[model samples]
Target: MTDTPSDPLKTTPLHARHLAHGARMVPFGGWDMPVEYSGITDEHMAVRTRVGLFDVSHMGQLELAGPDALAAVQHVSSNDASRLKVGQIHYSALMSPEGTFVDDLLVYRMADEHFLLVVNAGNIPADFDYIRSQVAGFADVDLVDSSARYALVALQGPAAARVLQPLTGADLSGLKYYWFTHGEVAGIRGMISRTGYTGEDGFEIFVPPADADRLWLALLEAGAGEGIVPAGLGARDTLRLEAGMRLHGNDIDRGTTPVEADLSWIVGWHKDAFLGREVVLRQREEGTARRLVGFEMVDRGIARHGYPVLVDAAPVGIVTSGTQTPYLKKAIGMAYVPTGAAEPGQTISIDVRGRPLRATVVPLPFYKRSRS
Candidate 1:
């Protein structure tokens, strides 16, 4: 869900295509990317109701091969990678010694002794270097930064499978959530994973750079029935926020530990050892002083990032991510607060531009799709 963007100097294969679609471009992470097409609200609703495509090629990728791949993955990741069977993916965090995030990532078990890591684009170089150093002492593990070798696009929403089924030979129905398969898509060989940041049913396709435009157009045409549109960073951010997905720069960062961020489910606590295992375990058993919590504005105000969160008119924490979601049409946000005050139904104050605004802590995932 950390779609803050990356590779500031590079553009994905679909850059020109985005321009042609009359997109408003913005600088994200390190790349020039579309902030919106049509408009943020329009694009956001399109994804919520029908389908939307996103150019996510700026994300970083790493390959770990050899007999020690699983060991290497287990060492750097919070999730238990050994439990992943072939074609399966698990959400994980690359942890530091203190159990803070190096980066949140996806661990794809491509094979028994081979794996692919999808990491944030801005942290690509840092992530690769860090992982390589961590696994340097391991026997027979080869780490390679293969970021430029592939292009990625996410076809997301309820109508995603309906749209993608016509473009790929792979059985979209058979690919369970977080699973992937190497298949032919729009006549090109690619890997399709049934995962998305929007909390919708969708697929992220990894294809060669040369085939990006082809695949992009093919999907647009295939999904025309569903009013498919090209969504950009603006919609992506709001969508993920509604889904309660953590943004790397805003919601979770080097300063925040996973447990404090309310993401302990990604940790494989039984793994005996890992970077930051000690800190994480301690926090797991004994809770942190402050915890991330979700809230909706009780008054008319937007509780933006960096705003002070107050208790009894005194500053205690800060807002990490907030927005007026298009689909939900309500102002919701997340913040870190004293653990005692983190429970839902509790009331808090957000310092909204010099004015203290009242808000109520609410359950996470402000929106959930009906899966009937």
Candidate 2:
């Protein structure tokens, strides 16, 4: 029997709406979230080809405001928050003292002294406490966990703006990628951001918890003719993976650093000081022993997480994330292999259930959406 998340699962405000839509619920990140609706492939293609919606309310939100809020944010975040203009958002990582990832998150500059942090669900409590601890020396830095008060929904794909533009007063076209504005979406006041995890032209709508279902159902009705389907975590993961986005716990965690994960772009080397600056700087100078890279199967086999990756019939590294990409129609995965074998076009082998399957290192993102 499949284990449902009824006993200790934290359901979102749209939990009933998911059930009403015949969604398959599962335990994810300490919450009862939709794993699939129509199907993973269908939903994945819907977002790639047309449009799709994802209820990402399980993500945690932290509100940081006060005199030293900027300092507090800069202390723990790997990116340069000092450069963020009001209403702009940037992808960043929360690093530990050892230069390893605490959690990868998005930093939203709401105002001069106010910032909002969108973090992964499972690391909320730890993130909150860690952030609080970081700001202990800074006076007047207030950390509030406002995750329960808001519901987040993502409308993604090429038709995202087309479907969402009519319902909101915000100039959807004017809202550039990684920027947000306070506007009414479907007559409900909230923050509408032109950001998404699907690596497409999309928007993440943040609204009051009580108004979640209304906006969800309304969006569905509005996009019924546009091939907009309710997507779940299954499609979400594949889409992000195809886009080369890293999962917090899988591709990056306490054991991995930005250097090894090929995420050096996020680190602000110019910044004076941060949690893991010293180690990251050293790693940048000396070079990482292993690096993350993308690969596709040469033989017929699917590589899963924790699968042994070998270069010369010996275990060199392990697979972090792997999947049969629905859109790519091939078995692709990301793994941290030795620096020598991390180059593109380098052939390697993945042990799939004791069988060595030949694979080749490709570029980071297996697929990129065309501008056309």
lDDT of 1 by residue, 59-98 (tens): 9899999999989999999999989999999999999987
Kindly give the stretch of ten consecutive residues in candidate 1 with the minimal lDDT sum.
1-10
Candidate 2, residues 1-372, lDDT tens digits: the string is 122456577899999999999999998888889999999999999999999999999999998999899988998999999999999999999989999999999999999999999999988888999888888999888999999989999999999999998898888878899999999988999999999999788999999999999999989988988989999999999999999999988899999999899999899889999998999999999999999999999999999999999988999999999999999899999999999999999999999999999999999888888864
Q: What pairs collide in candidate 1?
A: 8-30, 8-31
TM-score of 1: 0.97
Distance from true location, Cα of 343 in model 1, Å = 0.1
Q: Output candidate 1 Cα RMSD.
A: 2.3
Candidate 1 accuracy as lDDT: 0.92
Candidate 1 local lDDT, residue 194: 96
RMSD (CA, Å), candidate 2 to true, equals 2.2
